[model samples]
Target: MSAARHPWWYDAVVYQVYVRSFADGLPTGEGKGDGIGDLPGITSRLPYLRDLGVDALWITPFYTSPQKDHGYDVADYRDVDPLFGTLADLDVLLETAHGLGLRVIVDLVPNHTSDQHAWFRAALAAGPGSPERARYLFRPGRGKDGAKPPNNWDSIFGGPAWTRVPDGEWYLHLFDTSQPDLDWRNPEVGDMFEEVLRFWLDRGVDGFRVDVAHGLYKEATLRDQVRPKKPKKSAESMVERVLNDEPMWDQPEVHEVYRRWRKVLDSYPGDRMAVAEAWTQTAASMAMFVRPDELHQAFNFGWLGTPWSAEAFADVITDSIAAVSAAASAPTWVLSNHDVERHPTRYGGGPVGLARGRAATLAMLALPGSAYLYQGEELGLEQVDVPPEARQDPSWFRTGQPGRDGCRVPLPWAGDAAPYGFGGPDGTQPWIPQPDDWAALTVAAQEADPASTLAFYRRALAARREVFAGADEETVASAEGDLLVVRRAGVTVVLNAGTTPVALPQGEVLISSAAVPGGLLPPDTAAWVR
Candidate 1:
């Protein structure tokens, strides 16, 4: 699709804001006030985002919840959570973001709802076989004494996927026990989510980031997971096994739900759209989520999950671009987000990691589709090792895993000390403590340093707008000596993953992740040349 005909999201660069860690506005309880980030705090930071050059902001779930699984276990989809702010605060945020020319996309959790949600509560109160109970996946036990779970599937957060209630019926909860998966087969479920989508669109949200978009539907037969020859140990490996043709995930029926949702988004004005957080095993399967009549964009995690090598990057990018193009939808690239370890840390931690991360950022921006930047990435922030006592992610408790607390540490906006101006005027401590060593990495520090990572991001983003705004064509020039060269529009981006520097193609330099010495791109560096 051409830029003129496609929606703004097609060429947009989106920033993912993890709300609780972004900033704190209304501090109301203990320790210099509650210290949890709120909608008002996000509103107050609109100018910063606009200056950052992101076309839109995708805020993580801030809906009413009981704090289980953070805000992902939403109890009410229509209202904002008290921990974040009131519905009015969201209105102010939406208005302010729009005023600053930044679109806002909120998280939409359709696969499940918190056990405390009104419908779930009613389902619990009603007897088995009641219509209210039918809203969720409540099934009878399978054993002769009705003692065993209906299926042998495991929860993503660890433990059996089925949780037995007081009524002796088992309910499916793919994540946490408090987050019961909804039965999308029911017409009420689909209608409710459609209305939910309209409710937010009516409130002026630009679009939605559909959470677990591949998981809304499951196989009709709740069969046991097909076991592998050898059991996977680590959480990551186990997840990979489950995501590959699992009965409960990436079901073909899920497309029907998005086809209907596409109509809802289309009915709204202002080019509203939805991006799916679908996790499929292959690029083609991921592409299916963004078919013409489905979501506008689906995250290209194949690119995200690829190893730091020129060949690996080229293969994934080639496949991703081809798949999405075939589906007649724009591809979406994401390097870091709330759920994973920051790319900086993942690339190899410390200075080397930061260099690779910066290079990766430029390479991602050079692509011919939308990109998503996690908060704090521009500051070259590395994952902070939160003390075990300070970790709040439910995955840590459920799986005995370290969880995602490291990536969710509060952003250091300014100041040289802890909290780092992340809180309100009272200088409250952030929910998760910031590392004292991050003084030099604060936005204030980076803004003053022209050669800082933050500055590089600003220049790269600005250059992208100038050179590749409507440029969709991308051709792989060459992959030689661990260096990958890609030509997009009239701009050539050279990424060197090798240990030694490499000569750049003949062109004027538009931007570089690092200073080019002797007209050669340094190792772990990337540059855009016109």
Candidate 2:
């Protein structure tokens, strides 16, 4: 929290734009882009986001890659992939977005490089003990005949983290095989990333949304990860993973990297900053990423994963506030992202899930800090069950389980049919097919209805803007039995998580997630009063 010179992020609402599925830039007959979202697509949609009242937008990776894990596996750190658009297109997007009075943050993936990257290619060409191989985690296999991997670590995508090359040496990929982990112990890797940071900052971008911020470094000793000793409870799996002390995640050396990168950000004007996607086990561990000498903010996934209960959300929020307060930083809240199922579907499906998700969002927005909104949640979009043949997420291939394709479906903008105004007028079919049932979820339809989820979000954001204009980080939660109530900076936020109706507090109501009948808030409803 080395006080970002531009403090607009103090309570900013950032919208996450899933580039490939958001809106396609290709015209009806375009060949290269097919039907994927690109820079131009985003530039075309800036007015929509601005009108939606978000302070900034964070786009997922669009850099050059093999698309093995989509754009997360980077082959070139400097250029935009042709599937997305060109550099000139991105430059235009930055200009247009800034003109609309909205900030932009692009994703930065530094944890690993695509195996097709020049460095990795050179590593393969060169023999063992070569300088090129030193850039990535290349280790000799263990056991007889060098058939076994170096350790028992598993990839986040599935399977072993180590992949054996023809040369008898094994390389580490914490994710898909195409994404090989970089050796951060090497100073050259650090120097190369510094250049990458300066490249984007010089392009007039506002900041970066760092991908895998906690994964840049691994234990130098290549130690085995600690496993759960007892029969693991599904309820405790997340906490177990966090405190498991995994050797490859949340390493101390990762902080040193951010400390240096923070200096690069501080050097630029316009309040340049970075937000870490560090999925640390707890708020205390997560807060470590945003200390005085490090990055500005880290996503609080604990708040996002909490179940539907006043006690659950309250406990997480209390811990988050207490931890961030100690570090003199603000905690960020988010309900959905490109990786997880949409909250509307996770909160329970259909109408009940959507209502609970809306109420949860209202609760999060009412808190005194920054909040990140996934692209389609405002439209009450539920996860789509993409057909098996159409599924593309690598995790689906590695593990037979339903992958993240559900949440990555193309958004519907207009029209009553498939591809639904996705690419453009007469836009081609979406890369990941949009469902037929999404007809009513289109932005066009939502705009026509005053009671749509989009409408609720607009009013909620406006009210939130007023609540945090000059608000303090300090907050008080005086009511937390069945209903969750918090008083912050002269505003009171009450959420009815219980199963029955509750009396509304005495104040001028600013906004409500759902209709209030006879001054009584319905179950799974949230309201803000001042």
Report how far residue 117 has shifted in candidate 1, in Å: 0.6
Worst 10 residues of 2 by lDDT: 25-34
Query: Residue 407, candidate 1: how far off, in angstroms?
Result: 0.4
TM-scores for all candidates: the values are 0.96, 0.96
lDDT of 2 by residue, 1-530 (tens): 22244388877999999999887874435443367888788898899999999999999998999999889999999999988888999999999999999999999999999988999999999979999999999999999988999988999989999999998999999999999999999999999999999999999888899989999899998978877777567875755655676888888888999899989999998888899999887788899999978999999999878888888888887888989988888879999999998998888899989999889898898887799999999999999999999999999999988899999998899889988888755556887888888888899999999999999899889878776665774687644678888888778888898899999989888888899888899998988888
lDDT of candidate 2 at residue 35, scale 0 to 100: 74
Pairs that collide in candidate 1 are none
Candidate 1: lDDT over CA atoms? 0.89
In candidate 2, the residue pairs with backbone N, CA or C atoms under 3 Å apart (3 or more residues apart, or in different chains) clash, namely: 1-291
Per-residue lDDT of candidate 1, residues 1-530 (tens digit)? 57677678988999999999898886475434367888888998899999999999999999999988889999999998999889999999989999899999999999999999999999999979999999999999988868999998999989999999888999999999999999999999999998999899999999999999989888988888776777678968855764555889898899999999999899988999999999887788889988889889998888778789998888777888889889988778889999898999999988899999999999999898899999999999988889999999888898888999999998998987978888866767888888989899999999999999999899989988988888756655456769888887888889999998889888899889988988998999999888
Report the lDDT of model 1 for residue 72.
Answer: 96
